[model samples]
Target: MTRLNSAATAETQQSWASVLRITEVAAGLPSSEARRPATPAVVTLQMVLEKLQAGWRWVERKRSQQISAKRLRVAETISLGEKRTLSIVTVDGSQYLIGSSAGGVQLLTKLDDATPNNSRDERSQ
Candidate 1:
């Protein structure tokens, strides 16, 4: 009976000592450090807007380059009067003379490697 009493008393004292040590450690820390809450990193609105603008500019530049690098381009257009027009279109390095009027569009001719100084009379056709 006496041995049991002593063992119970020792267990209670050991538990109280552990509690006191924990309290002392907690007290040693700064109040701010102990109470600070965990939070995600903050991002400013200006920073986000700047990033968005940079991305938009990049997209616009790429779109412009793609448009300018297309395989087909109209080199020149001449109005023949009375709603008629002739257009020189370049496709994959080849040039074509197209005639358009109120009737419809027609492929006038496929121009050879002729310089721009040379002229052709469409009236003959």
Candidate 2:
């Protein structure tokens, strides 16, 4: 508290000095001074949130568009079960097999499905 009071007193005394000509002070002013406005603290927070939300929406739209491109780059295998099934794949590299055995080739379609790709053969149905 004492330290703050001493600093305040020093600052008060220092303000008495006109350290420069008015013209010199005007010339030294930063260019941004002309753009300054008396914005309330809540107004500043609102402006920041608006900018953040706009950027978030732009990112979401861009990310959704990239899904198909990323899907094209992936080449994964699908499996069918034990009776030795055979299938045909589409022109777009999608697999389709028609076979039904108790333990044979299993058809895998989505990437998020954690099916076994190691023991599968690649002849589309």
lDDT of each: 0.74, 0.49
Per-candidate TM-score against the hidden true structure: 0.52, 0.31
Write the residue-wise lDDT of candidate 2 on 3-38 in tens digits. Answer: 999999678545422222332454355879746663
Model 2 regions more than 4 Å off: 1-39, 71-125
Q: Which ten residues in a row have the lowest lDDT in candidate 2?
A: 15-24
Instruction: Judging by TM-score against the true structure, name the best candidate.
Output: 1
Position 85, candidate 2: lDDT: 45
Q: Which residue pairs of candidate 1 clash?
A: none
lDDT of 2: 0.49
